[model samples]
Target: MLRRTLLCTGAAAITAVFTGSLWHGAAEVRPGPGRYGPLKVPDTNGLALPDGFTSRLIARTGHKVGGLTWHAAPDGGACFPDGEGWIYVSNCEVPLLGGASAVRFGKDGSIRDAYRILSGANLNCAGGATPWRTWLSCEEIARGRIFECDPYGERSARPRLAMGRFKHEAAACDPDREVVYLTEDEPDGCFYRFRPGDWGDLTEGTLEVMCGAGERVIWKPVPSPAALPRPTRHQVKEARHFDGGEGCYYADGVCYFTTKGDNRVWAYDAASATLGVAYDADSPLTGVDNITGAPTGDLYVAEDGGNMEINLIAPDRSVSPFLRLDGHGRSEITGPAFSPDGKRLYFSSQRGRSGKPTDGHTFEVTGPFRNLVPPQRA
Candidate 1:
């Protein structure tokens, strides 16, 4: 199941107004820094990084403990600082075919604890971390729902069904605004935003879908309770909801989102509620699973389908190869999160072994990341 790599070179002209006509700008680009270090993995079918980068086995399939078998599949997750140790909220795609179990990994890579967060959810894709430090585990199923998990690996977590259940993917929150942005994991997926009735109270919220012009799409507020029954053909037929949205990150009054089936990243303006395309890969960048914005305003995208690699898109809309996975070609990379100190980058690989019945692996890449560029004034 290995696919060819697709690379784009040269820079396309991009023009935008900075300070009226007083400062028109254009971006200069070149070929991306190609693959670094050894591109082939050894022994295990995983990835190998450069000298400073290292990969370890946080948890894998069939690892037994306390007479309970650890589940195989893993997906979207986030890392939180808990006391002296770090706590990771991992997602288990499903229980049926051994897709169960979320583990809390300590700093030493040992499982501090584990729990089955969601049992029946299929394709539990990438999720986001709430400002309160809880994990919003999303289910990428036909009628998927988002589940909130405690950092201690507790099974008491429940699905936030009020968030408009439909192929749930990544969820990002604007802590200051009490607003949450969500992405759908479907072809032509719609970008959704949820505003809690009260700050910190997620039980009730207003869910809306992004619609209208490409760069002027407004968050057409939708009725959450009415959207609960089941989505109709007309409801899911929008072009934006067609390929299904994936990763979502909100920062600096803007929301960054990705489409796995379309290989496109879009940004939504929180002030005006407008949506615009940020980056579009011709091919090879297909199947982008999750996207996260760095402090430098650049975006890091995890490639789930096709070639397994992590790509970075600069603020100037220049896309380039960042990291490449060794050996396994189908390791669905998701959940790209930067450490609080901005030193290390962490991501999850859902399917290290290609074919049906895939098991995921967790990896960490340490590197220096630049902050995102501030948005220009209108």
Candidate 2:
């Protein structure tokens, strides 16, 4: 039941950073352009955007986009190019019924087709896009795992058990180091990286947990990736504890991730083995969740609670609001992926105005994206 769309090939090295004061109490008021200007006001769709941007509802829970029904509780998402058009894959965050769906778009930003990419997965929360043109659909349960999905819908999705099974939150593939970084959503979750036996194969690999704090960190092998004797997080006693790991993304030479419990965004330099904070409560952004990078080197972070805004952290490290959802205070934003051309962005209001999973709403924002800027090596 899959529609054919020509798959386009490309590579992206998007990354972002922050270098401002730190705080833990409340969001601090900082001065920055926000790249775009001050948001005008909420439009008919209850969305506030910059001058040249406009928003449109793409799909809703139990609703049909193209010909297939959209998934519920849409969470992590990523964009994949298809010829001149593109495809956006969104995860379903509902257990048992939680899987993922894909919406195919034409070059003119029109919906061409929609279909299911993965099914029977439990609580597929947040996942990453692979360099080999696959989507990593991660489950958010105690023994959850990552499923490699074909965006083209030609192949069946497969579970990569080697990637470790432990309350998986998100996955980001670091092409430079040939390692896939992952996050867990537990109070004392551990940051992990998996090095596949082969560069593009996930069947066999060494699962290692990050251990250390401050500037430099190290990775220790997890004796049991399957968490047989104990939970994966507990297997590595020396692993650095990350409170509630959420979204994860890789760009340039760094891996960026968020810890919702701590309200902090972290940057890990693959080359130097260094770790640093990219954003904290000191900035305006809060309830940091799914993260994605822009062509201009800005990292867009969606909020799980605070203000229902998607904040942007520029390469210069300044924090500012990119977009905010009004009348949706009860809902949180999930997914924040940019179209392959960087001209459009897609995200979802997990609960929409009603704050119910069945009321989930996905939207698209079209605007002029500034020129691309490669982030300075961290």
Candidate 3:
């Protein structure tokens, strides 16, 4: 039941002209798959899924047919609702191979459309979805920029260079305040915020670097694109030296961001403009990547390194193993996004020693968050 409306050439031009204020129309509400619970994957490279969970090949690398090229290596992703189907915007981290592009998949698991969103950007890592229904794909390499891709349109995509380009990892937006928060992938990277002058426009915004400590630390602020010199780390060299900020999410008047190298999640209060450690694992075995809030207020963290498993940090500071790779070595799991209905979870795992294709694959697991055997209680 997937439906696609092809825009006429004239209509497409008009849409691009009005892209800045495109939020005027009502956003369509989409439904989710009715079923829920753990999925089943017959072949996990000796890995294991939850009891009933299942895994199937949605797409793969080098499996070309016609003009459509397979995804070389999939990275960050965001699922956008489109008619009866869903537009799964995925990031292809390959650069030299030249197959990296944003691919859209239908609800029935068919390639609806695909486009090269960002060219010459290497390691297009993880990014967040904006309230305006766009995917912000980040580049992990030095001097990387964030690009906003409208999966609904074939040619309405562009890079948002006003967001203070750096080794961009992930970004989150506050729809009510029209503020966008971004994370740097550098070891000493500093957190950033962009306050757009216009609610619907992002090109003209006030960029600032976070400074100070706790409540005292404020978004000291920086020059806008017009006044600022060439965007480089040297201009804000003092902001460097972070523990490695990656995943970010905006919810409940706060921005929850994570540091993958240090395994810590910090909450920045939008009202007070202060950052504090929200969650940290007791052991150093967990390396976190993209993080998303569950419908019930729990936070799900995707593990990029260390042991292969998704960790759930409950409200009461109780951390438990939600999903385990169930094999040997690291799993390199990325993007842990929840379905709109919050019944199912979607994630991607890069190539491991199990010969599961270095190109990476997306997996879906269903089930309510439940307790597993604790990690031996310290």
Candidate 4:
């Protein structure tokens, strides 16, 4: 019940290209009038939002946002709460053994049950949500890694692998400085950080890689964290290579990320540790998959297929769309989490519209976002 949007004017001055092969930087931040601005006219029936935003069909692909049932290809998700209800946990890309599933909304989002929190593991897809709340399911292949669920279904999700094993594709955590950023979908991807010798422990850690050296960026150290025949992005040749990453977020100290071959949207800066590409590729937005960090700091990405729409970006990188997707068609829109009271935004339309494969769906877009805090850097 808060959609008046119409202020628009901020974000747009990017030059980014630090792995596009060497120098080029301008990590500015001008996200003014944004909190969902000047853009709203689609949502024909399911996702085309903006006129005060709206969407609710929370859980499909078999139906049952809860009570178990909804499971089939709905990629990446995270939301946990209980005692008044809330527990999303999606991510089940399927293929050989895929895994991750859960549901049980009810603070008005309805649905009261749906299960399967982590299966055999294999294509799973995006993940991230843990300050100690938990929900880290990844596994995109090439021996992917990461799995730490416990969204109320209890525990036993295992698979930490010290947090290194290529192909993953989504993860976030800056919990003040416990560090844990990761994203890699191939095309030679690479952008990680683990360092968990303790403090909330994630089994163990050390997997560096972010190297750059010119405008400053270092953390290199991954001489085969288990590439075996070699293949952790060729065992990291100094780092800085992402055009296939597909989603990341580390908040506060900043670490946003997204790289679907080149639809870019990056931002490192753990206090000028420098690395910026805050939305480039000309910028009309394209297949940038996953990504979520909005209470107002702006950022929403998630497209994975070009016109499935969902681009939000702001904070001066200015981008729009915020919603679009005509009848499914090509399918793509994975995860996009938000809702620890950030006002509800969870996403997924992954493969529905009769593209069958069990179909796909998982929505809930409430309204008036903008509660975003934590952004006082210098």
TM-scores, all models, native as reference: 0.79, 0.90, 0.76, 0.35
The best candidate by TM-score is: 2
- All models: lDDT? 0.61, 0.85, 0.61, 0.73
Angstrom error at residue 326, model 4:
25
Residues 228-346, candidate 3, lDDT per residue (tens digit)? 45444345544534588888987667778889777777766666554555555443227877788764555677777666766665554445555666442544777677655444566
- Across 3-122, the per-residue lDDT of candidate 2 in tens digits comes to 211111112112222222221122223447788988888999899999999999999988889999888899999999899999999999997988889999999999999999999999
Candidate that scores best on lDDT? 2
For candidate 3, give the lDDT. 0.61
Give the alpha carbon lDDT tens digit for every residue of 22-130 in model 1.
Answer: 1124443233543233334442435555444555565555655324455555667677766545665556665443223445545654556656655665666678888
Rank by lDDT, highest first: 2, 4, 1, 3
Candidate 4 per-residue lDDT over residues 289-359, each given as its tens digit:
88887656667877877778777766555566777767887688888777667778888887877766588
Better of 3 and 4 by TM-score: 3
TM-score of 3: 0.76
TM-score of 1: 0.79
Separately for all candidates shown, the number of backbone clashes (residues 3 or more apart, or on different chains) is 23, 0, 12, 12
Tell me the TM-score of model 4.
0.35
The residue-level lDDT of candidate 3 at 277 comes to 55
